[model samples]
Target chain A: MTSSSVPKRSRSAMDASAAATQALYGASDPGLRIRSIVFRSALLLSMTVALIAIIGIISWAVVEGGQRLSLGLLTNNPSSFRPETAGYRPAILGSFQIIAGVIALIIPLGVGAALYLEQFANKQRWYNRAIELNIQNLAGVPSIVFGILGLAFIVRGPLDMGFIAAAGSATIALLVLPTVILASREAIKAVPPSLLEGAMALGVTRWQAVWKMVLPAAAPGMLTGIILAVARAIGEAAPLLLVGAATFVTFDPNFWEGGYSALPVMIYQYAGRPQDEFHVLAAAGVLVMLGLVVVVNSVAVWLRAKYERTW
Target chain B: MKELGKEKLMAESASTKEEVFSLDGVNVYYGDSLAVKDVSFPIYKNEITSLIGPSGCGKSTILRSLNRMNDLIPGARVEGDLQYHGADIYGSDIDPVQVRKIIGMVFQKPNPFPKSIYENVAFGPQTLGMKGNLDDIVEEALVGAALWDEVKDRLKDNAFGMSGGQQQRLCIARTIAVKPDVILMDEPCSALDPVSTYKIEDLMMKLKEDYTIVIVTHNMQQAARVADKTAFFTVSSNDEEGSRTGVLVEFDETGKIFSNPADQRTQDYVTGRFG
Candidate 1:
């Protein structure tokens, strides 16, 4: 640790090496420059590959379905006898109702669970760890598995609310609940410890500190999570199938009382039909779903940019 | 000259001896491992007492225990008497939330809420349900922290907009807004530049006129410059566990501790020979 033991010539030794390197190559090393160029191009190539795939899919959907996408697509319900006039109006309304219900149910429950785990739970305890691990594992389970569970419990057995949009909503809510909880916990955990300590030092109770400081600090992240979960819920057709999302509902959906067909379920029904017109209609439904997903994700990004705390 | 130094020390010590906090045989632990063992000291009313030491010395840990902030950490426990106003802070009847209000804390880094400067200060008083002209309270606390002149023009601006020094002062303003009796500062200047550190040091001197302050600092010069009394801590090796525990090496008037420390460890640390 002494200066005497660290020879003064060590600096000169480093300088000499630097001078020798500079002499060998005047300003820059050609090998390093070539390596940097190669690395940069590799990264650029990877990005282009992903961009090409997305652009390819979107262009194909637009070209194939653009003719069928009209105002009538938004207003007219599906008709079995009239192939040209059949539309996804009921399916769109059904998707919205189901997503709205899912959002309403998930936000409070997911955020509450996250707050408990991050701010209140004693993480060292085995039960809390068990809950944490199970939530993570549940997020990875297939959506159709949730659908089966929903059919057994929600559609027929315990709750027994059969074939209603609310039942389908409940099923999707269960399917995405784990995703919301995991994302929310990450968001809540992102809040700085100093903010909590600052509030506590002001004589604010623990709950007050979390509510007033932590939750607000974490709001932008939670919003992003909710948006992503809703996106996933709207796109899932497999779960809706078992949870009683009817394939050919003609009426405008009622969430609490009637049969419903979501956009994906309608698309599925159309795609499986052995007719050229129905396939075009299915592509048009995909276009609508894609637009909705993009709009939701864009709103998430905007909300995050607006409300994100620098600290 | 020596006699003058001794007489001055005696006068300062005697005049400020009205005790605010008294600790006897205090031992702190995290889980089963000891952090600081058997620390005893008396902090006086309206005087600045500093805890100074190297890293892992538990000076900050002891400072936190005074306000029961240690309870926030899992498996952290405090043993022995840590008395605030003659009441055991660890007693069942005492609430940590209430105790925190009486003894406020400022952390090592400036951590302002992601709010306007005015709201940051107002938040504390609002939580306590103090009935008053909130505007006046906010203004008074900001002025007391010496930040009103700079931020008075933009009370509505987000606190993140301020410089690091201003932000730290805002934290002080926020702490004072609740009208706490004592303030605990944990390395308030470690993240600040020299000028900001000097300004904060000056503010602490002015603040001690109204509230008792206990600060933990790694910068020894800061301790010598602003603290009236200084307690030096050092890490002692625990042979059995191969762990180092913080132990109080010396406590005395800052001038005396710097010039004529009673313990060799304290002298070595202060003189920069060893820690």
Candidate 2:
């Protein structure tokens, strides 16, 4: 009978242990229900902490940033060391110009490379496998290394185009291209095989099916990936620093000319000056850049939500 | 419409039942594995030929072999003569894409593209570049599939919104819209309800007036019910790494095949003796 009651006995034994432990600390004697509430409360507390950290950071930035945000802040170039004396206009313009250049560079190269890897190239061949391996490795390689490569190749060594905006754009674009290609490949591959077969069975040619049907269906997710890649490019500081983003240029620089500064580099320069005014100016610049990235990423997220396929 | 009427009138002559295609000593290989061995069969104009067999018996293989749908499978190689109206279909220069344009197919599951209902029927005709009256052609195809009355009000609605039977019929409409000479079906009714199956069965009888259809089914009664002719396929294996090689065990008029079969295997299968 005792052996048959093993499950009940063990359960009671656990309750006895609880009671014994309760006797050792008299005030801690709560029911299972109360203990469960405490356990869940701990989990909820951790979640609240996470929420607080995120909201607190955003709130702090937004509050500190409110005073400096104006048309002058958005549209005028920087003077020096003073919050009233400085604006992110040049940096904002430079960021826009850099983003446009990177987009132009990425679309054709990234999508074409992805298409070649997925559709045209035979994955079974060793050379193709080597090429695939190289791309994956390139995706993981640090952005600073890409900057070094860009400086040696594009800025001075072979091409020697000087410290131009085009050079900075190209360097950042190259840094993010592998990410675009990798993401686009995943989006393209995620299209159902049944969909491909359906198209093929309809007498549409393979190229027609891929272009007209498959590409359109997969485009939204791929665009989302492109947006994230562009976001990463804008936030990147190491590569742009080496590629020559100027610290305090008053006028808009051409793609061919000297010293172009972007948002991050401008913020870095102000933050390093060690004056209270410069620190406030740096925070304002940080807010502006964060806002721009949020707007851009919001657009991408909107597009993804609008066109996302259930299948 | 007039041309279709004339074609129908001409086909009324039984002597006009010319051979649409012929396969001579045909062998199908998927990579190194042989799927069909030394198979030969003739397809007649405007006939419903049902291929029946057990699972993995290559009934679908024989159906796909007719239009080279098997070419979609990488490393699939077909040897020996497969002829379409006395032309060498497997010749190096002959494009399988072109062969496919002339022969459409409906799959087991009713696979409609995730598009509007009107777009689904229009897809094939658009690809084939049919000239003049796109709206008319779409309507005719839908009506021919016996789906126009049900779907006429909501041509702009999504294809997936329709019932399973409607989707299958839409697939049929898509196939006929291309004006292909033949249509191959692979277990099309397997995913259908009994009522939908009957409707499609009736649709098949009407479609045979214009298109040559070759179907594969596991249901013996379906073969007995709708087919004008029947082909029985079977597979055999030995001890040493034996591959599945489908053989045409019997072929005859549908009524004859069901009522009085010449092959022992055919009788066993039809009478539900064993797979």
Give iRMSD, candidate 1: 0.6
Error of 1 at B165 (Å): 1.7
Worst 10 residues of 2 chain B by lDDT: B1-10
Pairs of colliding residues, candidate 2 = none
**DockQ for all models, in order?**
0.66, 0.46
Candidate 1 CAPRI grade: medium
Q: CA lDDT of B82 in candidate 2? A: 84
lDDT of each: 0.90, 0.83
| Per-residue C-alpha lDDT of model 1 across residues B1-275, encoded as one tens digit per residue | 22213233223335556777899999999999999999999998888999998899999999999988999999999999988766788888777888888789998999999999999999999888988999999999999999999999999999999999999999999999988888999999999999999999999999999899999998999999999999999999978889889999889999999999999999899999986
Cα lDDT of model 2 overall? 0.83
DockQ metric, candidate 1: 0.66
lDDT of 1 at A186: 90
RMSD to the true structure for each prediction, in A, is 8.8, 7.6
Q: Which pairs clash inside model 1?
A: none
Off by over 4 Å in 2: A1-60, A63-66, A156-160, B1-14
